[model samples]
Target: MKYNTILFDLDGTLTDSRPGITKSAVYALESFGFTDLNPDELNFFIGPPLLDTFMQHYGFKEEKAHKAIAKFRERYNVTGVFENSAYEGIHEELRKLKEAGMTLAIATSKPHDIMLRVIERYELAPFFTAVEGSKVDDTGYRKSQILKEVFEDLHTTDLSKVLMVGDRFHDIEAANDCGIDSMGVLYGYGSREELESYHATYITENVSGLAKEILTCE
Candidate 1:
């Protein structure tokens, strides 16, 4: 269970971006004349790609999904992106991992530029060795694709020594596809049932638990 490298998912695993994402989603829905879209009901937007969320949750066609994404970015890029906060103890956990000599990286569905802004704003840029994310153009939104890019940037072939930590089924599934282990956190948007169904290697209820699991791993 030893790992030398850890890939993190940005939105839920490290930071609580629910407010920003939900607000932006509501803005997008409003643009389509759906003024009643509840921000609380938009929790599904936290982990997955915007395009998929728009289509899957709202029944938007591909073309309309793209448009909705644009509208989301219009607000998100200005206000929503900054409307986020790091989870409690996340900084301490990351510092501990870094001090232990583990390489850390970010693999997120968020666009690369925006992810960078978020990380930098939160002062998390120092801990991660690399950050790979989807493009603003909406390409490379799949967790698997994002992780592939992260692995490529890392230039590491030993998947056994790599661990991906996230809060969604997509993260675990992507780790499985990449031949790596994964840890799911419950303090984020995803449910325990979802993580378990995806066969995550481990699940933790909070940042402290997650830190303990990572530090104690073989």
Candidate 2:
């Protein structure tokens, strides 16, 4: 294994969380009397911080964005959370990496509590050595900040041996911030152009391809 420690992004990278995320966003918007919102248009909410997504897409102020996030979690925590599914081949790839003696960890902007619930729901907790995510209050939502906690939890400072794998530019940017390598997945919500523009070290078209890249990384 070229990289001994692998950090993963939860939402777009590990799971197809689009349905739960977009539906929750729609529910939140509807609560504020914003009807007729299309879930397809809300795909941007998948990878980034929910508060930032609400503010950026809807021009909501900070306070209102927080309210919108609160509403989103109201539905997500109960119903939408379990609506997610692990990507095809994800479990097998994770098991392969774990058996290869690689250290796998989750570093996501999703709330830590919700992350745990989702992993448990999918029976993916056994493969990971550590799981790190944002606080429930939306504090520590940035990908880079979350990665810091993940690295700290893993007790490692050697960025050279760490690799971040995700489907969004934020994941690449965060890895760049930490001076570690990053691989972007094309099968998730992000476009190929988006991942390339962020200068990801490698871009794989699917989970199998991603696993190959990690196992063969120089």
Candidate 3:
């Protein structure tokens, strides 16, 4: 294998979490007095940090954005979390990678507390060597910071042998910033143009193809 360690994103990558997230987003936006938001419109919320997304897209200031995040969690923790489902073939491929002795881990913007719950709910804890997620505080931890912590947890500094895999520009951009290769998956939320624009080292559209890419040298 060309890479010894692989980092996977949570939302829109391993699982289709839109229903959960957008539904909860509805709850939050409604609480913020914006009632016309289409759940479809919240697709951008799938991969990025809620604080920044709200501030950037909805014009929320930091204080109001923090409250919106709280409202998001209010519903998300109770119901929105379980509204997600894993993609077909992902679990089997993750098993294939694990059995092949590759180090697998999760690096997600989902808050650390909630990420733990979601991982257990989806039964994905067994395959990973390390799992890192964003803090539940008011801060939106950058993907770069999250990946840096992941590298430390995995005890690997050879960025050449590491791969970051996800379905968003944020994931690829962070890998680029951290000097690691990245694989952008189209089966998730990101488009080929989005991934290519960010210069992902590899791109695939399905979990099986992703497995082939990982297990093969080229």
Candidate 4:
């Protein structure tokens, strides 16, 4: 590929972190007297905005959702982040991409601070040129807003040359909003059917397969 930057999503794309997210989310729900989250339900909250999960599933008003977000961060910052791991082949693949002269960036919906901690802990931070994520205070948690921040930081002139790589429909949707190509990973939170429904330009079944797919993209 002739692209300069490859923007990746965190959570499902880089880490298989449903367990940590599930635990922390349930803790937040329990702290607020809501008990509707089963493990499976909690898994659904992994890739999207945390506040959206709180509001949709718990019926929490914005004020209460913000409080729950704070509590969620308290637990997540202390413990949940370490509960995740980089996917197999991810580190090597990222290093290879970086060495190949690609400018790597992270455009995730996770809070920027949390994303930084996870990236640094996993030693993934060294591979990327820049990491852009959602607000640290639980604001602008949408994928589109995060992508905009990343593009602005990179001073990218060609949106068509940018590729969004993620494991969910939100990533694909955000790429559509930004008028860029997107590739969905089947190994993440979203299923093939959902990714196809969003019309992902490409799809990779594994981390090792990503480089090949990207090279083949127009």
Please give, for residues 135-218, the per-residue lDDT of candidate 3 as tens digits: 764258899889998999989978888999999999999999999999999988889999999999888888776777887845
Say which candidate scores most in lDDT.
Answer: 1
Residue 131 lDDT, candidate 1, scale 0-100: 97
Each model's lDDT? 0.89, 0.88, 0.88, 0.85
Compose the digit string of candidate 4's lDDT tens values, residues 106-201: 999887888888999888998887798777554436789888988999999998789999999899999999998999999888999989999998
Better of 2 and 4 by TM-score: 2
- Give the poorly placed runs of model 1, Cα more than 4 Å off: none
Residue-level lDDT tens digits of model 2 in 121-143:
89889999999888865533788
Candidate 2 residue-pair clash tally: 0
> What count of clashes does model 3 give?
0
Q: Which residue pairs of candidate 3 clash?
A: none
| Cα deviation of 201, candidate 2, in Å | 0.8
Q: Estimate each model's TM-score.
A: 0.96, 0.96, 0.96, 0.93
Model 2's TM-score against the true structure: 0.96
